[model samples]
Target: MSEHKKGQPNKASPEKTHVENTSGTAQRARLLERLQAGPIDTFTAIRELNIVRPGARINELRGLGHKILTHRLTLTDDQGRTHQGMALYYLSTNAPAQVTA
Candidate 1:
């Protein structure tokens, strides 16, 4: 056993790199966590995560290779206000596949 040089790969050990966001971190984390329990809708996502631009965020996630499913749903609100909106669904049962260029 010997000490490895800086910037040199340790052939014996695998390498891992983790990147985080300063702002969108919370939204991304929340989305992933909640997706495990069940699917989440656009309105709920925006309200709960305080996401100013959910479309952009969803696009970013899609770019990252997340298989998010979206569908239009007719829902009634707390006051019985009914409306049609898009619902974003993520299946926690499916494992995340690596994105390939």
Candidate 2:
């Protein structure tokens, strides 16, 4: 007579990996600090922050890609009238693309 037995390894038990917090208010603060440092142009700031889409927000401006739109600057006259003209380029480029899953 002979005995037969079977054993298997459990795949369900797994270890969890640690992940660091790379986003939030801290990152924004750092970005703002870099922007104010002096003689640093907008494009350089954008690149340093790795901000792909530079000015996607109202308070921001785009730099280094392609120009999609033009902004008209309005200057007020002594009589309280306004004049419109193209604003000088600080840096211009195409807008960055969004990421998707």
Candidate 3:
């Protein structure tokens, strides 16, 4: 006689399951790790987090009373492809001392 239940599969066998980590989830995890480490400059943090430019928009509603600003960032990937997109900045805090073309 089998040990299995009359209507159900045996408990000795288990179903396999697979889970995948998404790019966005992985990015957020990295971002949180960085933030817990210390205070870091926005640009450097953004680069380290592997965050692409186009998605980093500043919330206008939150920036209405502050001196926030935005600028385009150009980056070259390891494959030598150039990407262009906007990076948000806080004018009073993040503005660089020197201007570069």
Number of the predicted model whose lDDT against the real structure is largest: 1
The Cα error of candidate 3 at residue 2, in Å, is 51
User: Over the stretch 1-101, how does candidate 3's per-residue lDDT look in tens digits?
Assistant: 33766887432111111112224434444433443443333455455555553133224312334344445667565577877763434344545545232
State the lDDT of candidate 1 residue by residue for 1-101, as single tens digits: 54779897432211111122225645565565566666666777666656666666667667767766665567776677888865555553532343111
TM-score of 2: 0.27
Indicate whether candidate 1 or candidate 3 has the larger TM-score: 1
lDDT of 2: 0.33
Order by lDDT, highest first: 1, 3, 2
Q: For each candidate, give its TM-score against the true structure.
A: 0.55, 0.27, 0.33
lDDT of 2 by residue, 1-93 (tens): 223355642221112111121232233333334333422233443445444333442133233232224344565545777667622122123
- Tell me the RMSD of model 3 versus the true structure: 13.9
Best candidate per TM-score, number? 1
2 versus 3: better TM-score goes to:
3
